[model samples]
Target: MSNVLYEVRDGIAIITLNRPEKLNALSIELGHELAAAWERFQSGPERAAILTAAGDRAFSVGADLTDPPEIWPFAPGVGVHVDKPVVAAVNGLCVGGAFILVQFCDLCVMSETATFVYPEAKIGLTGGLITSLAARMPHKLAMEFMMVGEPMTAQRAYEAGLVNQITAPDALMDAAMDYATKLAGLAPMVLSTIKRHVAEVLPKGPSEKAGIARRDLQAVRESDDFREGTTAFREKRPPQFKGK
Candidate 1:
């Protein structure tokens, strides 16, 4: 079965991550499919899109450890730039790389049971996601998440202005679709123009930002801490991080 699913109806493109058994963990295959789905939404008749994932356990637990890690085309707000607005229907656990996807959406509707986290520090990786979180939220709160690797509840996310709305699990998709449909009714050109304008005023171009992330990621990968972290993760033990 496909790792990702895409369908368009009523001018709303719905994209779903389909790896439920893995808690919707993102693999290289899924990433490619997701990028294609975004491209289709941008080039097709759809005025807006809704991003979701299959399963009640997770929106996405992050990257799939079974597959070699590589940059996905849909790195959100970085690699894939959608001219039309997008809404995130966060149903459950949103962690690590998954939170980056949420950061890219123009609006978010998360289930009350959902949680957000960035565990890059614990895994000894860093860069764009860390910087992006700081840009999207208060510096202190962003630091708390990035540095401490703690999970943030949906209500906390709402309070921090990271998500627009929170709903019961059953109502999550309905809320997201309702919002996307409303956005779809707006003038397409106007919406596109607004999105473009916002992008233009951002501190850096997407490519430049991505380049910085790549450089930082490379440095992290070469560090001893990275090897230790990965080893500990595989061994199911706490990592011993050293400044080296």
Candidate 2:
């Protein structure tokens, strides 16, 4: 079965993390699939997107340690260039890398059973993307969560402005979809302009900036022109290049 599921309805894209048995862990494969899903949503006709997961256990238990993913590629504004709105519908145990995913979303709604945690400091490993949380919310609160490595309940997260709304488990999807649908009806150019401006003003973490740079490098490295240049050099001739 696919680790991610993508669907479009009512001008909104529904992207589901589909590994409930593993608590939707952000494994290496899942990260690539999720990144592709986001790219698809950005290039498609959908005006807004709702990100959610299967099962009641967790949105994700974060990374799969034994087979960790290079998560930056899936993070919004880092590797995925999405200007359309993205809404996170979180339920239960949103941990570590997972919280960063929610943190980058335009809006979020959580189930009463939901909780967010970032245990990287205690785990002795970190991607440093969590530092961007300070820009998204209060500095002290962000520091407390990342440093203390404690679970922040949905109520607390809502209070701290990390989540837009909290509802029953069954209502989580409804809440997220509501936000997506409303956003879908708004002026696309207006919404994109506001999103671009906010991204410009917002501070990014070290790893996030690195991810964007890496994505740019990866594009050029994979381009046909790069291959042509290398081949021409080997053949002792001038390279023909296409800017694409």
Candidate 3:
């Protein structure tokens, strides 16, 4: 089965990560598919997009260690900049690299069973690039999560304003869709312009704006270690990245 699935209904395009067996890990294939989907969503007839997953276990376990960055056209900001709108319907564990995906969405509706974390510290890697976007959380709380590598429950995330709403796992999609339907009805031009305008006003720190995300992403994107991670994954063995 494909790692990513795309469908459109009633002016809304829904992209589902299909690798339930692997907790919907963000593989290279899924990345490319997602990039393509974004491009289509931008130019296609859909007025909005809903990103979701197929299984109950994970909205996404995180980025697939096996896939190369360029394998898919999608990157942090490359594939598409729809401005049209994107919503995240987060169910189950939204950990590690998985959180990156949600961070890019316009709005998010998380399930009560969902949780968030940046476990890169556990793996001896820095999460600087992705963590830069975690500014939605309080400075102390964000620092605690990055430093301690502990998981935060969905309820805590909502209370902290990191997430919009929390409901049962089964109701997660409906809740997101309810919001999407509302967004779809607004004036498209007005909504898109507002999003872009607000993005321009947000204060980005010197370090954050100093190409930090680009530098960090480049390190992994071009590393021999990344290749090792993918090879080992394909062989069903743990990766012994050389940090090359």
Give the top-scoring candidate (lDDT): 2
lDDT of 2 at 148: 96
Question: What local distance difference test score does each model get?
Answer: 0.83, 0.91, 0.75
lDDT of 2: 0.91
Candidate closer to the true structure by lDDT (higher is better), 2 or 3: 2
TM-score of 2: 0.96
Ranking by lDDT: 2, 1, 3
Off by over 4 Å in 3: 68-79, 204-244
Model 1: runs farther than 4 Å from truth? 204-208, 211-244
TM-score of 3: 0.79
Give the TM-score (vs. native) of candidate 1: 0.82
Q: Which model, 2 or 3, shows the larger TM-score?
A: 2
Report lDDT (Cα) of residue 113, candidate 3: 85
Winner of 1 and 3 under lDDT = 1
Candidates' TM-scores?
A: 0.82, 0.96, 0.79
The digit string of per-residue lDDT tens for model 1 on 124-201 reads 765454465676778899789888989999999999989999999999989999999999999989988988888677
For candidate 3, write residues 1-244 as lDDT tens digits: 7777888777788888888999988777787777777777888877778999988888887766776343213532323455787889998888776776677678889988888887888877543445555456687887887778899899888877778888888898898888888888889999889877765765544433444355457668889999998899999999997877
Candidates ranked, most accurate by TM-score first: 2, 1, 3
Query: Local error of candidate 3 at 108, Å?
Result: 0.7
